[model samples]
Target: MLRELKILLLLIIVVGIIYWGVEPLAHSIMHPKVAPADYEFKDLDKIDLSKGDAQKGKKLVTENCTACHGIKAEKINPPMDNASSASSYGVVPPDLSNIAAVLDHNFLANFIKNPVKATELSHKFGDSNPYPMPGYDWMSDDEISDIVAYLASIASKNLSDKDVFTQACDRCHSIRYDKMVALTPDADLERYLGTKAPDLSMMIRSRGPKELSVFINNPQKMIPNTPMPRVGLTQQAEKQVISYLEKVGDSKKAQRDSLGIKIMIFFAVMALLAYAWKRKIWSDLH
Candidate 1:
């Protein structure tokens, strides 16, 4: 027994040393040194959102965006299937149907101004892709805001949670809820999106809304090498999406939490009873 105890002690010491030795290295790797200026739109967190005119936004979308994006259930370009679209561009550009329902004004403005910078990939990798979406850096900030407002104005307020997620997130993300499955196969998905997207069923519970908001708004700000694109969702749409996530992932959190307290109390009572019974049984011996 003493020999076994010595071996166990040695094992624990080795493990403790290894953990302490690796901690600093892990921290350094996770928090790489990058100049503040290197970060794209680093000042966006401090920028104030400007209200936009949807009527003006509509004109801008027609003049600037109709080449790639479609609206009003009609294809501005020929209806190319997913394969064809993926072949042309690395990934298919999602439709803008009711986009205002998913994205907030702030996100729309930032993304529309410079999608590459918003995603932060181009800032780091220097635009390595063969087919890149050019940024509208020349468009005045007001014009971008107006475009966002236009999208928001036409957004369907009555859209279900699933519809919002499908339009906003389903293009890349996969949620393993009920019958909902991944849109792209693994082989094809990796070729375009760079990596297989993680399932978001338990995402809300794992990372709360605040964390999700920061990450969703600017993934690179939170995670240095994430493949997630900049999805400029409206504030209201973000809330709706969070609500849906809570329904799917943490629906029973309240009930489960309540039950947990009762269970702990029952265990405490049983423990006390067990101790009292032990005392009674040993009284005669004492």
Candidate 2:
């Protein structure tokens, strides 16, 4: 009886492991999963901060963005200005008062054009249908840059480089700036662990430094049931993550190319499987 019980327990453990692995595989196979894509911010690195016209940008924002984003760029859904009642959607619009301080230009631009990629909180935090923000892909790159400049000018506080780096980057990643610089770009650090590491390229494209920083500080606050743990980070790490994101945003085109390669690889694997099945290649093994 004891031997039978032990065998049953072992079988259950094996079955559980197989089940867990199969779920993710099934999701990948059945769903037409849209892999995250990078956004190319044209010539953003070449932007001349000295030449930025914040006042002009502000005027343009008033004329165009105020209707949806708000006059002070504070409220959108519940109406920050009114505060009398929440919107029918029961979600308060995100306040943009400290947007420049809280988010990087790349993140801000992505949010304006594709709110889906702006913050993981959007997907993780609320219901499936949170208040929808309009996409402004029609806006010119210059106009977007100008708006960023204007926002930076009005923001109450700008995070110091150290503060940002410590709070954001160090929270989740085991990043050593000096060590990172010393390693060759192609070095596979995870080879020692016999497992592949998660690609950070997608992370940079999907989230800005500021949003990442805040999420690191308290993931539960943003998304109640998030699997991410809150790693207490100093402000410096947060700033570093923000700076890193800015640099990543400049290489957005390259990131997109990499994403395309991944998609091709996925299809290639699927094709190989189909060919093998057609040829009965696994008949003996099965």
- Considering every candidate listed, which one attains the maximal lDDT? 1
lDDT of 1 by residue, 1-286 (tens): 4776799899999888778877767866865643322223345432234667888988998888777666754335534665665566656667776776766556557767766665566643454563246778798777777888788778777988778777887666677874465554555667766778778899998888866766766677677777676666555656677778888888998899999999999999998899789778879788
- The list of candidate 1 runs beyond 4 A from truth reads 1-42, 45-51, 72-78, 123-127, 182-185, 202-214, 234-243, 249-252, 284-286
Q: Which stretches of candidate 2 lie over 4 Å from their true place?
A: 1-52, 68-85, 120-131, 158-286
lDDT of 2: 0.50
Error of 1 at 9 (Å): 23
User: How does candidate 1 score on lDDT?
Assistant: 0.69
lDDT of 2 by residue, 90-165 (tens): 2224344555665555656555654543443344334554424555668766776777778777765655554354
TM-score of each: 0.70, 0.36
